[model samples]
Target: MVATTASTGALPPDLFDTTTLVSLAATLVLLGAGYAASRQFLPKDAKNSARVLFVWHAFDALIHLILEASYLYHCFFSWIPASSVTAEDLGSSQFYMPQPSPFLGHADRIYGPQAGAIHGNALAKLWMVYARADHRWAGPDLVVISLELLTVFIAAPMAIWICYDLSMRRSRANVLMLIVATGELYGGFMTFCPEWLVLSENLDCSNFMYKWVYIVFFNTLWVWLPLYAMYVAISEISDAFAVRDALAKVKKSN
Candidate 1:
């Protein structure tokens, strides 16, 4: 069985060793510079900026949902076309035998039955980003993947509805938008708290960027964004009730 099979006891060597660190630093500098440029060139009104940001945020989230869903669908279902399979040979079968690759195959081992050996294997290092976020759970791949699926199916639609409402009802929508944006930003931070803690406790895992940065940061939205949505929903419902009460009082007076 693939689960019991021992790997070659090796890792995919760092593709960028020295150059990677330099590139990473350069990327951060560019991001910082871009943000500064936007702030300087873009208009300073809070309302206008928030409106633009909300639209972009919604679209960004949508794109992320699509890409992640594609990854998951390919990972668990082995649905990618034969030509896309990376193996070198037909290996006595016409159908492409799904061997593990960096994106899809690794997820099955980490989140599926073969997780025990996968946990200790060097290949697992690639998943350090997600692992660092929820090390206490010892298995976040399934949870994270599930959440990503939910985001694609559920959260993305809700975000769209909220965005639509914002575009239509400026005052009310702006309030909800602010609330959601606050929640998103806060949740984004909370998602990474686990990674920060993990790095503090285990410096070895810090070597992998996924472990300390991307995993928790990327996967955490499913956990927090829902809370924000709920808050907005409750507030909207309460406001509706208030309007009903006000109309009833006016009719009685008349």
Candidate 2:
């Protein structure tokens, strides 16, 4: 799949130069839309909390964009700015060269079979393949990275919001909650399924904690949190609908 390939293989090197700015703009626009939607539909009293959540998502998206942009820059520039690099910089660097992780101690923080199934694992493979095959990881790598991050940071949130709204108006917060929770649980499972393959198929992981505990646990959060949020939204919408019905009955009686 294209997801398993690196941008170094297809895209031109110049793309990463403005990646940060482009992502920042896109994130801002999305956040703005969320804020506007809340203002249009939500009661004034409810706007604050919703707005806060929106802000959080906006920030998170920006962070995600930054992370990927940084990765792309590193892939092209062969060096990252010291201030922006995370602890995983080492892993990222090795991944750039398509090297298996040297930080087995941190593998739990990063590797897995589920990752291999997701565009994320495919993305890593693309880089690895490019590095190993004497080919550049470029266009395909960009698509893979963008697709994976978009689902986690953007599409997931929107899905949750939709589910939440539907539940709330229908007085089905409980159902919404279940949906959010289950989706997250499922998403996490999906995320990890590929890692088992990555490990067993190639004997890639050298550290248990880094691969299983850290990577599995933390990445699962993205799937879970959004699902939960959608559940809350559904419950709220359900309440709104009930109130509307009660008022309609009162009008009919009068």
- Candidate 2 off by > 4 Å: 1-55, 72-146, 149-209
- Tens digits of per-residue lDDT for model 2, 135-167: 223212333344445445654555445434532
lDDT of 2 at 131: 29
Model 2 whole-model lDDT (C-alpha atoms): 0.42
The best candidate by lDDT is 1
Off by over 4 Å in 1: 1-60, 77-147, 170-212, 219-226
Clashing residue pairs in candidate 1 are 128-211, 129-210, 129-211
- Candidate 1 residue lDDT tens string, 120-230: 432223222223323422232343455456556755565565555554445455455555455555544544454465543322233335333443443454445445545
Error of 1 at 27 (Å): 12
